[model samples]
Target: MATATTHGARDHARAQEGNRADAMPVVPASAWPDPPCAAGHLVWAETVAGGGSTHRVLARGTELRLTDLTGDACAHLLLFAADRPWERLNTADTVKVQWNAYLGEHRLLLSGQGRVLASVTADTSGRHDALCGTSTLVRNSRRYGDGSPQSGSPAGRELFKLAAAKNGLSARDLPPSLSFFQGVTVREDGTLEFTGSVGPGGSVTLRAEQDVTVLLANVPHPLDPRTAYVSGPLEVLAWRAAPTAPGDPLWEATPEGRRAFLNTAGFLASRGIA
Candidate 1:
């Protein structure tokens, strides 16, 4: 005996109540993994500003987490053997040895000497660019006009030079660096295209296999088409991690991964490190 209009009005009221329930605030969860070490036992932690840089010496078994505090950020990174600075990350070698152009979780970052420098144990931002190198002053000036370290428009290359100098390196020592969180794809015609792939709270964790010097620059990707030179802050956290064991994700990722781990283990054994 209820009219159709009355039923319609009741339904509408119910829908409105549902919408209000859905809009209620919920606590946000962390995108990063819990610290490998106990709480308050981190070796170091810092937040690098946009267009800024940092350098550090990471010992073997050290776990470093890089988090994009905001979305659409790029971190240009380079690595070198602390003892032998000449041996550094080789992008071509890493790509060729892995038999893949895409770098994500479980990929080993190899040095030019065919040894493992670091292993990507976990990655939320699945895509990283290794083809296009870091941006240079000349390239930045041509794209964004007035690319000068003094003007606070420091390019990735300039940042690396300054970071390296602090560790007794020179401009000539700079090598091609890996740009994290910047997605690059291969087109049908063999051309490379850049795309946005990371969002706020996305992160990547790297576990060092050898004593290495890490250089990082928070800068825009060379292929970033944005007219504004906006970069975002990145949070870095380092801690001691447990030793890698057999059947680990990184160890069983590929045959090459196992081989690289063996090589690194041999190197460490020679140095009297377990």
Candidate 2:
């Protein structure tokens, strides 16, 4: 049998030196005190490559911002209450109760129990989706030839599963996700139109309404009509901020939104969180 270790053996010493990261992997909170997050002290920061994944446990009042560095990134996000993992994102109820499919600033992400898991505080990327979640392994393989995690075009579901497993979750705990940087609109005829990102540098910030575990898969939108796998990188940043107040304007924005906020407040109060 032939062995292929000759080159690697000669370059072992050099490999470690060259393998070091070219730049800071994470941007500190004080690195940039910019708009959107100008007031808060950032607590977490990361950049998930295309087809990659990540997870975060955010405390209530922490705001997370996801950016599509390039115009092709898609963010599939799943949320679970940190204290009670069983309570998770319920998109159907989010859309049904809100009476809207498209999402933007001031929109609340509701859980099955009618609690506001998170709320969109800022959104520069107008394109988002309540329909057509993220891509799956079967679909990725059918389209790109290989959907394995090691492949060039990995499935969003598999990436999510990997992220979830790190936080002690499993496939059964997985539910449909809410996608960002990509969108879908239903016409009067009941057909679907997929919308890609408006442009590069688009971002959406979500404020945790409760202490929550957030799982993110930065992959292509399943509905993207493109034949090639051309997604871009995703930037995840979180900063410390105050949660909603009882008399805040968002709480009174709509009858439905107010009810969701009230439910969230009740849960917090019961836990003696004041």
Candidate 3:
């Protein structure tokens, strides 16, 4: 038989224990380190504004990190082999090879020829969109009633087209892109829904497996249902990384990863890059 006073004390003690447990330090998923390059030596860095785009050529063994400076940022990215421009990233192959519909960390960006183009080495925003493509000028104009680059509301396709022209590529060369920091969910009826999951300071690091030309558009996803067209800026950082070792995590992520890496390695070796 316990008294009311004893019962109250026990309840208080349990509450305190729960409070202490809640106070324990918990690390966020996005608390990843910067690229493994020299602390002060950055190859390139820039802040891409919403509805804007940028492109750059990255050498093999180099890593590029994209940080969401503001929450709700989306970066649509396309990768092409620098040497062989025809060999570009294939989103279908990338997802099919890994047997995963969702892209995340440790996934290799596979080229059209089943070769590794780049690898997602580190990712703070785990949910990236592979199915929903970028928004287009016509689509945006129809949706928002204003999709002019001059009006400062260019669509993702418009930005991608401009970026492609800078690299001497044409609209026909533009393929499907991966939308980083944007998440999509599939309903029971096979309908896709856009979901925001990234926060400020969340970042994703991609390690190039070959000399790759990257085209990125900081724009709202096509399925983004925000009425006001809220797209945030993205911080880009590029740094040189060490050569991939035999025990690299990307290579060991899956059987498909190993195969794609070997294909890429063989291609490079044939080109006298051994």
Best by lDDT: 2
Which pairs of residues collide in candidate 2?
Answer: none
Q: Candidate 3 at 161: error in angstroms?
A: 0.7
Candidate 3: segments with Cα more than 4 A from true spot: 1-36
TM-scores, one per candidate: 0.84, 0.89, 0.84
Taking the tens digit of each residue's C-alpha lDDT, what string does model 1 give over 53-127?
888898888888888888766888999999889989999999999998888888889998888999888899876
Clash count, candidate 3: 0
TM-score of candidate 3 relative to the true fold: 0.84
RMSD in order of candidates: 14.4, 3.8, 16.1
lDDT of 3 by residue, 91-144 (tens): 999989899878878888889999988888889888689998898889889888
lDDT of 1: 0.82
What Cα-based lDDT does every candidate model obtain? 0.82, 0.87, 0.81
Q: Candidate 1 vs candidate 2: which has greater TM-score?
A: 2
**Residue pairs in candidate 1 whose N, alpha carbon or C atoms collide under 3 angstroms:** none
Tens digits of per-residue lDDT for model 2 on 58-93?
Answer: 999998999998888899999999979899999999
- The Cα RMSD of model 2 versus the native structure comes to 3.8
lDDT for position 92 in model 3: 96
